[model samples]
Target: MACGRFKELMMASLDGEISAEDRAQLESHLAECADCRRELDELSELSELVGEIELPRPSQEDMMKYWPSVYAKIERGAGWGLLVIGVVVWVAYGVFLFITDPTTGSMTKFLIALPVVGALMLLVSVIRERVNTSKTERYKEVER
Candidate 1:
């Protein structure tokens, strides 16, 4: 294996997930290449440091800190922002589609196409909002 592949194997090896054959190849390359050997050493040190560090969680006060701002953003009608974003995205997509698709398709066909495309975009925006809400809930749960 080349030095690049050797580094990849070395990472997998450090994770205790590399096959024996791949491990042997990595070892052989490290023996022959000084640069790879140094890289492997640095990566191992980084892995050790990461393993020794502890992740800190939010305090109750810190968790409550953003509540006012978040609520204010919502109470101020943030839904309009979502609507605006949806319309912008739909218009951009429609323009691209119209430019690419020929004009010979009937006026009624084109008119129907616009709403269907807009509805699909609105559906996408709704799904995105739901996912974002779920993620926020998960984070709040973790904080508590």
Candidate 2:
């Protein structure tokens, strides 16, 4: 068997979860591979040391606060979303006024529209770039 396969078996053996057939195969591999044997020894010792350690438990009060903390974060996000929507609606109304107001000359209207159009185009470009970047990063993560 290859070293990789034997290493898997070694891990199972350390956990005392290997079958008789796998144990026999692993033992034979360990006899021939001193490096694997050394690794197995180290893993065994580490597992034993870790098993002897104690972990702290969370307090009941802390556990009770967890849900409220999570809800507060979600509430904050929703509040920000509504704020952004309100600002966008207000800006759009102002832009509409600039476009439709009879008092504004054609040249003045064109100048106002120019900045709004440029800003919208820049926003769209930034959103597209971010989306493409996120997709590429997700693909790389999946490949790994």
CA lDDT scores, all candidates in order: 0.84, 0.92
Error of 1 at 111 (Å): 40
- Where does candidate 1 stray beyond 4 Å? 64-72, 79-144
Write model 1 residue lDDT over 1-144, tens digit each, in one string: 356667678889889999989988887887889998888789999999999999998898878878986888887777888888999999999777866777647686678788988999999999999989987775666654
Backbone N/Cα/C clashes per model: 0, 0
Would you list the clashing residue pairs of candidate 2? none
Ten consecutive residues with minimal summed lDDT in candidate 1? 135-144
Model 1 lDDT, full chain set: 0.84
TM-score for each model: 0.41, 0.66
